[model samples]
Target: MSTIESRETSAISGDAGLSLIELIIYILLSSLLLSAMAVVLVNSWSTQKDVASVTQATNRGQVIGSAIERAMRNALDFDVDDATGTELRVRTSLGGNLACQAFLLKDGDARFTTSSGALPTLASDWARWENGIAQYASTPFFVENGDVVTYTFDIETDSAPVRFSGEAAARSTATGVSSPCW
Candidate 1:
């Protein structure tokens, strides 16, 4: 064995993997990194949940508002048989007789119901019945001049309630195309 070989052997033997402090430091650093990642993940999840709630609430509100507005606006002709606080019977050019109204379900959830043609037909003529809607706390829907319906809507959401108020006037001036349906 030469001097160089002996020195190499000693160096190799003296080599150790890691000191205790180095191992502990590495563990602590990794723990801190994992904690940071966990915090970020939790915050991201919370923000996403909040955004979803707002989006759902906004969508519901828009649907309810637009449906009523469109029901009054888009009619080639319409008749207002009964328009009240919690009930509306407006036969539009779209939904025929026995069409639409706002009422509470058996479980107390308020909603709108609309049908395409008269009932007793085959394919479910119900266009779309948006649920989770309520009359506004202060003032509900009321009729003006027997053709314009003014309403305040309350949309139920998981976080909080949303409200919208507007007045919709029927564009119809037809004489007696069809008798009004309830």
Candidate 2:
């Protein structure tokens, strides 16, 4: 064969395949890249779960806060039931003899019960948090002075507990009237 042909054949044979060391190095690099990617994916998923937990807790807090504020605003008179500060009894003129009682259940849920007429019996839960995901960290309480009523409580969640507070004024000037449902 010609010298040129021999040189060409030698070059082709030399460049035909990768060395064992080069192959091993490539595999290691690929494995490293995959590991990094997996870590990043895991971290992202964890962050998402945390965000969702917080959002759910916040929404639940808002709902409970709004309900309490509405009840307080419509109340002609109200009483806080126990030293634990978990119970509130509100009487509204709009509902006639009907009254609302908000209390914390044994399972850490907050609920409302409404009753009307003389010799009133226990009623169904008006607003209940029974999902078992969110709970009351502290008993809810009210601070009343003159015509203003303030409600405050803490709701517990997986990530962090949220504090909810709100104030409402009575629609009528009549205060200290005896509640029929008492």
Global lDDT scores for all candidate models = 0.58, 0.65
**Candidate 2 per-residue C-alpha lDDT over 1-182 given as tens digits, one digit per residue, 9 for 90 to 100:** 99999999999999999999999999999999999999999999988988887788789877767766676677777766446555566676656434544544334566666666432334243556544323244534666566776667665666676766778777855567645656
What shift in Å separates residue 129 of candidate 2 from its native position after superposition? 2.8
Best by TM-score: 2
TM-scores of the candidates in the order shown: 0.62, 0.78
TM-score computed on alpha carbons, candidate 1: 0.62
How far residue 53's Cα lies from its native spot in candidate 2, in Å, is 0.9
Model 2 residue pairs with clashes: none
Residue ranges of candidate 1 with Cα displaced over 4 Å = 1-15, 74-84, 93-108, 115-128, 134-136, 141-146, 174-178
What lDDT tens digits, residue by residue, belong to model 1 across residues 1-182?
99999999998887747778889999999999999999999999988887787688678767666777777764434443243345444556654432433322111244455555432222133334556666665464444455677766666665667766777877765443433433
Winning model by lDDT? 2
Judge candidate 1 against the unseen true structure and give its global Cα lDDT, from 0 to 1: 0.58
